[model samples]
Target: MTEHKPGGDLTLGGQRVHERLTREEPDLVARVLARIQAEVADYRRLPVEELAGDIARITQQTVRAFARCLREDRDLNAAELRQIGASAVRRAEEGFPLEAVLAAYHVGTREIFAVGSADAGSADVADLLEVADRTLAFVGTVTGAVTRGYLEELRTKIGQEHTARRTLLSVLADGGPVDAVARSAGIALPARYLVLSVELGPHADEATPGIDADIAIRRKLRRFLAAFEHSCGDGVLASLDGPGGLVLLPLAGRLSAVPEWGSLLGTAGRAAGVDVLAAADTAAPSEVREVAGRTGEVLDVLRWFGRPPGLYRLDDVLVEYQLTRPGEARDRLAAVLAPLDAHPELVETLSTYLELDTNRRRTAARLHVHPNTVDYRLRRVRDLTDIDPLHPAGLPRIIAALAARRASLPR
Candidate 1:
């Protein structure tokens, strides 16, 4: 074990000061504790029992160790340094901030020096200087140990929390014992959750040949997560990657409106500098697995139809969503558009005409053709399908047929 020696060898005067500090050790410990609590707000907020028990004991041991180092004319050995670091780990586990932990040590050291040097006269200059130098050395070593230990523990703790959250989300998305998983994760299962299945469009940087696409994706993900945290409080559980992921927002009992969460997609997209699409639904805790499945299906439906980026619920694309379902009805509707498929131009014209709300001029403008050409195409469609494009009754069928056709095509 390496022993840290605080510079010069201890002289007779340094020994005299150490003796005085040893005699006042008990009182000095008390003074250190009181001063730490008084000066550091974190310590002051600790419960009385903890303040008197663990904190007091640790403070006393630290003071004794410091005095012993001075008396032995050497600094803490590796084992003693490890002990100080272990105490810092304990403080981290107890949710003590690293700054507060360091503050406690600083306050303790100041009090120790003040008390040990209280009785020194002008003739005791060498003794006081030795004490000051030793105090600085001890503080430097102790603070470094505390910082390293606290940060290491904090990193481990954060990793554990992230793993737990992912586990909880997976169990909620798939079939599992949600209650037990939630317990293990130390998260309360809300009565209801707003489930979102997200898809992210590629950022421009992803296409730049010189740029690392993975790095761009990762940056977008970080921006997205930050946006989510800012818009929605930290209780949101999400599992996301570079492209996209799933999110589950815990809804407060009758207080949280689901629509509020739907707005997050736009904010997230803008922050990430990418287009975003999400399919959202609300479900109770028990129904999360089923609801998640449906939400993903809805998102798939949106992508199949080439819908614009935004938040979509089942209702947003109800007709298209239902038409894509496998059934005799969907097959029949898809067949309705098959006749016009032989003439690709007619099919294109009909689709553009309907999309333009039957405005022949707008359809003509979009197709870059004369209005007469659009009329001729519609007539050709009517001739082949025997479905009048102008009739209100036929309009519904044509629209449904178009949706069915688009849904059936290769995605």
Candidate 2:
């Protein structure tokens, strides 16, 4: 088979088309740009005087390059391709979507064909066809180059932003001075902030067997956290580190004003298949590390206790928080509840009784059992653990032991 070449008849036809196009270059360029501006919404939205000047300059350059390629019978070189690609990068930075930029290219191509056809009325049909084919191929090549450049620039910008955000988060997490870090990050530090620790829930696959799966999970978590931060407004900041992440919420007024934070975080966490645990008190910038440590402690206690998946706060589990601190004390408290392990129902009943403030009727209603059954379970618990639920003196130890037992269970 013979190799195909774009010379001979095609080259001769290209030369003729080139001459004709050059003769009508000014009129054709103006018509093509006008059509693009009329058809593409983004082009129309640009400032009329500035946009027209840019279009005119680009159109002239494109027409001159196309004519030269047809006359010379050569593919566009790297320099020419880079010129077109640079235009795409500018369009992307100016906030034009890829689709819109591509649409403008299509409009320009259509106008070029229309103008070529009208101008070449007396020329051979075969020659016109050859020019049309070559023009279309050139457009495709340029379009591909532009798309690549646009995506490359976009990825570069995203990577830079990610680096900056991670740097700021690291400074904050390390308890660095807020004013300097905030200024560097282009953010304002609030007077008070709440720190949250988020992690994949019990159901999530912690040990997924592959680097790819781990990377995918990290990407998913990042996207979810980004969306959550956006929904929480301007003062919210978040960062991911390995399997867990942190979110810092800046409060303008009292924390009481944002009672919905827990629910909102819960909804976001559940949607992302993660659990969110937060510190109870707001911290100043200087105390960020302290609050962050407390948030981690809360997460540890919740994990050890086998709590259900959801949002948790330090204040909500204060008894467990305190009990889990002294390792020996926690062990002894766990031992206190070990005798009731054989009768798990008794432990459950006792927990419910305490939760309902020692009200047998309320505990029964909550447990969906008879009040007599609740009373019997409480008595059994008291006998097995040597801690009376009704006796005021032993109540604190009993409650602490129960909380420790809950924390010690495997989730």
Candidate 3:
């Protein structure tokens, strides 16, 4: 900003102003007309909306700063002011009406230039005019080159950070030093072993118009995480992204009153519209990394099956029976009823017969068939499957198979 002295003798106080504008303002532009013109040519290539926004924001900030400097009677250098103007030019959004920015430079310059004396200022007048006029011409080229460089640098860094975060989470699952990373990320760990999972949720496939997905997703994560403060005890929260985010909370360690807490918290998650599966690790913070590995199991279930969102213990949902080891236990039992397999109707008959306890009257009543038919299927099963319907081993295998099949059945 140029300041006028109270005395009649004018002095060029060029030390207080920003540099970019000094380069672009007329007193400065005249010296760099060729460069400035080339820059303006490049500005024309940018979209009008982008340019306009840039111009509005940049001018607003610069004008405000210039006004302050002038009011303060600051003695800024003329060269610095021109550089400030040029810097503002760089920030102008596409189609930012370079003319308006150039005009603003003049508006700001006139305010400060008045402080100087005709004798002293006239000496630098030619140089100032040259810098200002040329700023309009070369601003576009300088700004574009600078912007491209910045964008490349920003994108590279963002990619590196995202990949690093993912890798850290994976290693954390395998007993890596997660506490240090957690602290750096601003996560606090303490009592309260709880579960958290990230989900793409219902809108995964839906495209929202006029919304930048990255921005929207981040906003959503912030909102969701805030809700947990009241819902769980203290601990570090790291994102295990997918559908639901996994949060490892330290247990309060007084496990006396609420043994059924897993189900309790799970129910709350369901009500909140977040499907979360948690496995409780011990209360110790040192045990957290090991617990993180078990998170994969929760993730698997989250992916493979639709478990009702309710507090659930990992132990409670145990796989009590196996479908794969059919020959080892279940099949040995099944072999007793080999004849039953050969008799196509034996399965139905056995089910009905068991219900009726093989009583002819009850079997007939339940099957809606004659007693003779019931007896016939039973005999055929005994012949083919190699065991009588009344065999003790046969009953246990049948019960076990029913239980196994029930669980494997898709709901």
- Sorted on TM-score, best first, the list reads 1, 2, 3
Q: Rank the candidates by lDDT, best first.
A: 1, 2, 3
Compose the digit string of candidate 3's lDDT tens values, residues 251-280: 554332355455444444444444445544
TM-score for each predicted model, relative to the true structure: 0.74, 0.73, 0.36
lDDT of 1 at 315: 86
Highest-scoring model, lDDT: 1
Evaluation by TM-score, superior candidate among 1 and 2? 1
Winner by TM-score between candidate 3 and candidate 1: 1
lDDT by residue (tens digit), candidate 2, 48-71: 775677667777777877777877
Candidate 1 residue pairs in clash (backbone atoms < 3 Å): none
The 10 consecutive residues of candidate 2 with the worst lDDT sum are 5-14
Q: Which of 2 and 3 is ahead in lDDT?
A: 2
Q: lDDT per prediction?
A: 0.82, 0.73, 0.47
Per-model root-mean-square deviation over C-alphas: 5.6, 5.8, 15.4
Error of 3 at 385 (Å): 12
Q: Worst ten-residue run, lDDT, model 3?
A: 4-13
